[model samples]
Target: MPAFLESERLVLRPVTASDLDDLVALDADPEVMRYLNGGRPTTRESVRRRVLPRLLHEYPCLGTPGFWAAEPRGGGTFLGWFELRPLDDDSPAEVELGYRLNRASWNRGYATEGARALLRKAFTELGVERVTANTMAVNARSRRVLEKAGLLFVRSFTEEWPDRIDGSEHGDVEYALSRGEWLRRHGG
Candidate 1:
């Protein structure tokens, strides 16, 4: 499939059924799942039944799948996935941005690159007014990526987690960027 977006080092394409194995393997790394589920590996059955379907669903607002598999520009490997999904299925005015990468892809700037590219698309082409993201307050790495992608820290709040993870006690932090704010920052 053609790319949904691209950055200097990554290509974002709509996720497909063929990506199941890669998704399973990405979720298998305990370190990768630490903040998400306290190092619990997501079972293939779970990925197949629940995760893949969510990733594959096309959002009417965007007229495309909300999740995109991340790979190298030349199509090397599945580094992970990125999401720019509408907060409401029928509206593109506000969206949630997120990413998950294999441990090998971490600390290499792929996350920031892909995120900035998505932000650009959201504001300039997708008619998105605001983009928001949340991560565990203790996830410094993810927080840094959000900042680098131009999202400002909005607040810290707690929510019920079905199964609490290691840093759940610290709550979660929300970061966001309004289209107006983005344009000011980018001199648009």
Candidate 2:
């Protein structure tokens, strides 16, 4: 397994072909998918054929950067996954940071902890100029995670959705933090 990073309470590692079941289970939870896919569950086959292959392929072409499965440090139980995908336009030092955790891990600061670690890696190791995250405008929980990680709200904008949820009309919010901003927040 290619380990990308480690935080105080979590381990961030690359996704392997064997991680399909864990990924499927995480995506199967309705609450986890509420804002992402209108609470629609993803099929195992879709993950096997589409998602896993794409993630694996991305690592090589993108300089070993892609999705990392988050596991508890001591026991290494799969909690969820974090993504640090490079922009398709090939912009250097510009990547999106995102996470999805099991419902069991909600409100426990796992997301914030993992995100902060990833942000640090992006700015310091990957030479990332900026890091961005986005979630449903009504997802206060996710927004709080972004804020706790030192990312500020950049905008709230509406986009067409194939499967609209009750709050889809409220649009989505984008949060961002530059490398300089992160440094200032850390007083380094």
Candidate 3:
């Protein structure tokens, strides 16, 4: 079956070949890429040749896994993307959550909405034991989203960035929540 999940205001569908244009446009926005690649826009060639292939190859063999192209419900606008998958191929029980939204969608609770929905699914139906998210130390926006999604502050660590962006000097922070924690938070 095709991969998909729906929230009240978002429909997260698998990233497919046809989503190439939307992916490119999302990456082209410097505002959206500010935290990811230092505001550098991804070339269309890269999307066509590399990125799309990687996303297409990752459509979970079973459940709706990997990255999803998130759009507003009952619409065609590409708000952004969200991911809820393992840190690596071998770590099935430990998942990581992440999102990248267009500037237009910012401050509208779309990010938190998608994240909460993903977390609920992970703990309830996806066999996920732990969920983690990391972002630049100075990224208050993303930090807030993670917190609102019920992930607690885990730790801060420094890592070398190949292309070290403007805020890379401050290191990164990780936030996480386990299945037990989720259950307790939701009174399950």
Candidate 4:
């Protein structure tokens, strides 16, 4: 089945080769890439050769487990993408949830909405045991999104990044929600 998920105002479709341009453009925005790559723009060649190929490879064996391009539901304007991938050495049924939205789309609640929808799908349909997301400690906006989606702060760990941005020393925060926790929160 073609990987497509929908929210009230957004459409989520698997990232394909045709989405290279949109992906590149999204990653090129300095503010968008700030916490990720030290505000450095990604080269189109890298996006095409490496990023696009990786996304395409995930289409088959990954089992609807890759990044999905996010667009406006009615107009199909590219907003950004959401990633739901199984961790290395993990079963397909267990996945990590993530989102990256364009700066223009920030503060509009798209990220939180999309993430909540995915979490719902995972728990209700995919038999997911847990869903987790990570972000820089200083990224209060992202941390808030995860919290709004019902994930609780689990840990803070440091990893070597390519370029330390303005707030790397504080470490990265991990947020997670287990199937039981999700069910409890919903009074199931």
Candidate 5:
């Protein structure tokens, strides 16, 4: 499949039905799902019914799927996925940035690389006015990746989570960058 985006060591392509196994494996890892679902393994049925459909749907505002399967540059294992989805179905002004990689791919800079690339695309090619991301406050590693991708801390807020997980008491932190800010920073 042709890549939707590329970085030095990774390629992001539109997610497909063939990626079901990879998604299942990525979501099954306890370490990977620690913050997401308190280490609860997502059943393959859930991946098929809920996750894959969301991943496959092309946002009307963006004219493309918001999620992409991540893989190594020259064809390798599925690393995980990256997302740059519009906040609203009809607007591309604001979008959320996200990534999930298998345990084997963590701490290897793939997340940061993919994130930076997405931010660039959001600001330059996609007509996005703002890019935002958030994670549990306890996820220092994820916060660091957002910072390294050039987003600044916005605010910390708490919401009702159906199933509370570790660090839920600490709330969540939002990070964001505007297109104007990005242009100024990149001299675009």
Candidate 6:
């Protein structure tokens, strides 16, 4: 089993066909999808026909890695998923960082640990110039994780969602780190 990247606590690997059940369960959790889809459960048909295909196919396209299945390096428990993929594949330097974790895996610094590892890979190995992440403005927990992972508060903005989540009125916040900024804090 090949891993795309490894942190001290996590082994980040691409989602395979074998990951459907895990992905479905993760998305079905209300807390996990609170900010994403307002806790609306994704139908099994949707997961099978839509979500899994995109996740499965992206590994070949993202090259270095796309979305990853984040599992503990210790006992190999499935924690959740993390992503560091280009917004536009034609320009691979501007990547985005995002994560979704199991409720059981919450508050354990797993998110921060995984995020920092991806940032290190982005700046040092992948030559990414900038990485950005966004979350609902009221998602203080995720905001904190992004900051802890070295992404600074960039701005707050709004997106017109077709079906807005509960906290959308507060808008969304973006956090970011540049290669130079990352090196300044963590050393090159």
Query: After aligning candidate 5 to the native by TM-score, how far in Å is the CA of 78 from where it should be?
Result: 0.2
lDDT of every model, 2 decimals: 0.95, 0.85, 0.86, 0.83, 0.94, 0.87
* Residue-wise C-alpha lDDT for candidate 5, range 118-138, written one tens digit per residue: 999899899999999999999
Candidate 3 lDDT, 1-188, residue by residue in tens: 24378999999888878888888998899988998889999999998998777666552422455788888887878888898877666655888899988889999999999999999988888788999999999999999999999999999999988898988899999999999999998998
For candidate 2, what is the TM-score? Answer: 0.94
Q: How well does candidate 5 score on lDDT at residue 126?
A: 91
By TM-score, the better pick of 1 and 2 is 1
| lDDT (tens digit, per residue) of candidate 4 on 42-158 | 999999988777665563334564678888877767899887777753465567889888998999999999999888887887677888899999999999999998899999999
Query: Candidate 4 versus the native: TM-score?
Result: 0.92
After superposition, the stretches of candidate 6 with alpha carbons farther than 4 Å from their true spots are 59-62
Q: What lDDT score goes with residue 86 in model 4?
A: 73
Q: Which of the predicted structures, 4 or 5, would earn the higher lDDT when compared with the native?
A: 5
Count of clashing residue pairs in every prediction:
0, 0, 0, 0, 0, 0
**Winner of 4 and 6 under TM-score:** 6
Candidate 1 local lDDT, 1-188, one digit each (tens): 88899889999998999999999999999999999899999999999999999999898988988899999998669999999999999999999999999988999999999999999999999999999999999999999999999999999999998998988999999999999999998999
Give all TM-scores, in the order shown.
0.98, 0.94, 0.93, 0.92, 0.98, 0.94
Which residue pairs in candidate 4 collide?
A: none
Candidate 4: regions farther than 4 A off: 1-3, 59-62
The positional error of residue 62 in candidate 1, measured at the CA in angstroms, is: 1.0
